[model samples]
Target: MSALPRPARTAGRIFAWTVAGLLLLAVVIAVWVGVRGALAYQHLQRIQTGAAQSTAALAADPSSAAPTLARLAADASEAHQLTSDPVWALASHTPWIGPQLAAFGTVAAASDELLRESLLPLATAAQNVSIDGLRPVGGRLDTSVLAGLVTPAQDAATRAADAAVAVQDIDRTPLIGVVGTAVDRADDLFSSVSTAVDTLSRTSRLLPDMLGRNGPRTYLVLVQNNAEWRSLGGIAGAAVVLRADDGRLSLIGALSSGDLPRGFTNPVVALPDEVTKIYDTKPARYFQNLTQIPDFTVDAPIAREMYRLKTGTDVDGVLAIDPVVLSYLLQTTGPVALPSGDALSADNAIPLLLNEVYLRYAKPADQDAFFAGAAGAVFQALADGRGSASGLISALTRAGEEHRLLAWSAHADEQAIIDGTVVAGQLPVTDAHTARFGVFLNDGTGSKMSYYIDPDVSLAWGSCRPGGQSAPRQLTLQLTLTSRAPADAATTLPEYITGGGVYGTAPGAAEVVGNIYLPQGFELVSATATNGAGFAGGVHEGRRVLTFGIDLTPGASTGVTVTVRANTAAGDAQAVVTPTADAARAPVVVATCGAG
Candidate 1:
């Protein structure tokens, strides 16, 4: 081409250079966003890992939890800063991946808050607690050391509750798929933490008084004999007066049920009308009959009152523990040597106390003496600090979770903390919102056959409709009982353990009163035994209850199936069983209905 104008050529060159510069800028921005997103994701992964490790470590060794928690707090704070960076915020407005980035940012912020405001403070406070001082030296605890922990422990508990509320309010649903399994895990961790915090808060408020902050507090400790089963757990065959003065626990007195007077006319607390209708009103006639009422809330107060009438000393609270709980304690204390040259270890405690005692001591008097000795030995070991505090705490936690250890306080304020806990041992009130069931067993044979009884529970739901439709959903609960006695149980077992015609049942036969407590919204459709027998159904505490009698011989088995229909939608269902001498491995089946 000919030589064009110089001005036009200059303008074309400038426009070309401007286009190249703009492309370069776009590439630089894209690289920056990508790198920042990757870093944020990496930080999130670290936070998840650290949180899990910290939780496990804390549970494993609560005495040394502060270090792991502090590290976790630092990591979480860094993640929060990284996710909240300006780069991430700008990327959050970008197309397609914007929602993911925003969800991650929310999770990061919540995690940071939980670690810094809740876990760190609680762990730091825990570090200051001296569990060793709670131990008794020469049968006396230094109350001053325990008293010192009250303030820090209470402060930590308050912070934990606040953190729990914060975590509960955060919305983590949007972060589920974006963060893979970490989001679900975090949700579960937070839920468990919330529950723990709530418990800690309650414990903090009650611990001071329970440890005798006001004055000396006396508790009636009922050693439930699971071998002779009752509605709540077992018959209260042996009891001890436990006095706590500023956290120093001492066994004041011990007595067997036979030693208590019978048929006390005076009532400490009036029995609930429902209790009178279901169980007899005369719960104080015999010490063993105190737990005839299925609910321990009813049983515990009655037991306390009965103790007062007999001992003439008012108890501030009542605590019930079965042999299973004792075994758990033995695990922490290693073993206890009784005065009779017999040693009770964790492995042998349950069997020795539950079964072998019946065999070794044919007379009830000898059995009582053995139990008293064993109890004293274990208590003395605990007082002497032979057990690890962490182990003891874990053991008690497990027992409480299984409902083997129960407590009820006479004080209204103290009892309020225990009212809704599993250890409170109360039946559920009428509520359409939740599903609850109970499988309770009472020894109709009036013998020690319960030691050989094995129970299995299976639950399943059918035709469940969501969204509160009045659909009739079926819930089936089948309980199978097997007698684990030896083939020659009739001859090998003691006469007293083999029924002995105590409750008008056949000799060598195990008779059980099986009660199935249904939910509030459920109606009993049918209840049948394995032998085609029918069950008697009634209403107690606004819930349908089915009662049946089961009799099994040695090496025999029987089962009862209870079916109920309800208008409620299906959700998570739970069954509370009467704790036995050993924990039962019950199979749980969950079935949900409705189209996706």
Candidate 2:
């Protein structure tokens, strides 16, 4: 307490001052780290929110999306800088919080690169063009404007794909909790962007020739009637002839099945064995029955030939769409006023076109006229720029994904691009490692009874065999068919819809010809149906096929289950059902095979 030697006092003062200085330095470092980390986090959140909003807007309205995207890019840039700062880098090497900081750094860098390389270019391209202008006027599209988009879209698509790969390349196992969740979300977002960009790239490359950039082209557009169901969704009850020249599209003619000459000889002499045996060669004489063969590639050419016999002109391609696809398009175009003074909106298009038309018009001629008018009105609305282009594209993309829309090109180059796409409407070429199941329905009642029919399918596998590079498995498939019509449908529904004994079945009953195509190397061990029904088993196209007959009364439901012995191991199995007038509620895969 008392003052001692001067040297000792000086030493004590120096020690106290040194301690204070060290404590202040520590506080400064802690404050700097906390502020920087908080700012980085705020920018990261903004990047995520802005990116999502911009992506949604890009699909619905690209011009408006541009600003949001710009903001997102700016946020991402700031995040990248903050995460890459020297302080953060040194902290990232520390324990506990190090992994989180590293993960943030990776995401920030990837997001910044993606925005600059992909989204900005696309947004810029979007700003220059009007979505409405994408539609053709007087059957002519402004190809020059569309041409300008191809390069930018392609570049963005390539960059997006690369960015997705880069994001996937980052290792996120070290990060945990919120940081891990954020990284996962970023990965998922980029993955979706990659897929969407790939589709855009393909579209840009193909649109020019498809729009008749080189010369005039004619296409046959089949309006499939899902009410009178066929293998490929529905029968070709109505069709339109579309002529495209120099990026302009025009409706040349419309024809219904009744318009074609009856008992005319089929110009197609040879048919696939499956067609000859299952449907008979007379499918050519009946335009509506041409798609009875399950494969669209086989059915499209036959319908085209029949059209040639009827119209004496060849078509360059064929496009098939069901009532469901029309409904999807209506969602984009809003409501269209039909010639009959009836309006068709997205909510009502399917029911009006598929069911009400049959109920309203007993005469085939009147029904045909209504269909032609409705199709024309919708097409005219789209061509006249009445629909949003982005909306239309989204609708079409959704329909194509569900197989409700399909296309076949006569040109080898064009068809090549379509070969593996969902719109190609082909069965899986090979199913060696993966199992495939199909539930295809053809209306055996020869009536509009299909309108009341709802089908669901499920596939379940038991177990894999032991000790092999590729193991065999046991599979079970269950198909459920329900008739949603009123119990008094026989009396309430029109005679045409009830079949009227046209196909030699009971009046007002739903008769369905069910086909199940199994994966390659699969053997039908047994097949059974509810209520004592039977099935015929055979092999077609290197795949096991099962054919069965089912009859359903109003308000009745039945289930058909098939058991199979498969020599091929199952990986990712898929079920392909016939696209219906309504979206299907069937599960794509029921169960996975486990190691025995």
Candidate 3:
């Protein structure tokens, strides 16, 4: 109340200042402790999240799941080992950025809600982009606020980022060093994932260049039944995409049912480690030495693979996307334009055809909220397939219903020569395998397509073995199809298949015609297609080709001879027709008469 003496006042001032300093010191200590805790927590969270994500991103089969875990583990080891050495002020050099980021759960959760509200479209679009055989990109990893934490971490991220490089030296096990270089460069762990993506984007195509047959025509293709494919034929460069609550997508890294890259014998790393700690626990434990599904050069341009081994081999196209993405895409555009010059409207085709995105921008309508639950089911299916097949089947069915427009032809039954039917086995051939589909068309008419299958193709212990190995055996086939439906030959014949197979048109594909690679040197020797009332066989080279004649007419018969030229009279004029009679019923039909 009354004025105090200067000496007394000074004493009080000292006491107050001292208390203030003590409190400030305590706050600083609290923040430091908090940040470090966060870092540890972050590492753990990442491990947990990563594992769950890996599981969610794959098929239930071990063949599908194992490689995913290994790749993710490897990638994580690399991420953890990456070190950043930004030039920061000595006074400001903080080591707790990683730790503070550990606390991102606080602000990030709130920001996520806001982000999510604005991200519905982004999430939807992200799904479609992935389905269309492209990677899902552009979103905060529920990590934006974590980035904010970094800004306040007093150069903590900078130091930790740099240290991360040093940590990478040990990252390599008997076979290591993925992130060591990244860390050694003092790279920021915080930005490593994003940076890697940027790096790959600029340096080269994720997969090989979109080369032609020179490179395997690696287009993206998704499978409804991974097991069936493996049992039948296997695959190459196969990857699957899944969605997150935050509107971002995490790739379930996997190799194709085909071959692993050179020096990568163990595609699926089973050991778990500190790096694996950044993902979901069990799944992380399951896949500790992985990061991403490698983008293989399933398909490439002729020029790109000109000098590479096995030139003139390529994937037809990529088939990617899960049921959720399919549902969303089908729900959005209503129908899509396929390379076949048709409009696809069925939702089922969404799963099969999402890979061939020629030239187009993303439209917001591609996402469907209904797909979320089913998508999660798919993730669960991958993680706990043995525990939950019903759930997976439901997810597959629901999603298929959402976009089941394209009914890809399947070789259901062939009484004479069983070729592709998994049920009608021929020494356990693969169910199906392909990267991208090489779409070919002739307007309203059929097309001349060369479907590139995996090179290491073969069948297993099935009686109808067609010359294969324990490994897959692939072959290149060139097919030529002509249109029927005289009305503009440009209106219906190829229209239905193109529309359904490539564009997602309703009622699915009218017919998908192509020759299964026989390596038998068979040529279109003759044709009865021209004799069909109101139809004519198409032409190619300088000869009138017939195989791709008017598609099968209901209750009618059409035949085209493929001359095998006796391979020498000793070879027994022996020949095997691809896509036997039953194959005619496939979503992509290539057969003679009353087939599918």
Best by lDDT: 2
Residues 346-404, candidate 2: write the lDDT tens digits.
Answer: 89888999999988999988998888778877887777766677788888888887877
Off by over 4 Å in 3: 1-376, 384-518, 521-524, 530-557, 568-596
Q: TM-scores for all candidates?
A: 0.81, 0.76, 0.23
List candidate 1 segments past 4 Å from native: 1-63, 77-110, 142-184, 262-269, 428-434, 463-475, 523-526, 563-570, 583-596
| Rank list by TM-score | 1, 2, 3
**Local accuracy of candidate 3 as per-residue lDDT tens digits, 1-596:** 64999899999999999999989975775565455434534443443344444333322232343444554444334333221112111112345333222222222222122122211212222231222122223421221212222222223223323333333222111111322222222212322322222222221221222222122223223332211111121111133232233323333332322322322333123423432222222211111111111111111111112112223333333333333333344443344443344444435443333222211212211211112223333333243222233233334433322221111111122121112222121211112111111112111111111111111111111121121112222222233332222333224323222343353222211232222222222333222333342323333212222223234322223333232211211101111222211111122222110000
Candidate 3, backbone clash total: 139
lDDT of the candidates, in the order given: 0.72, 0.77, 0.27
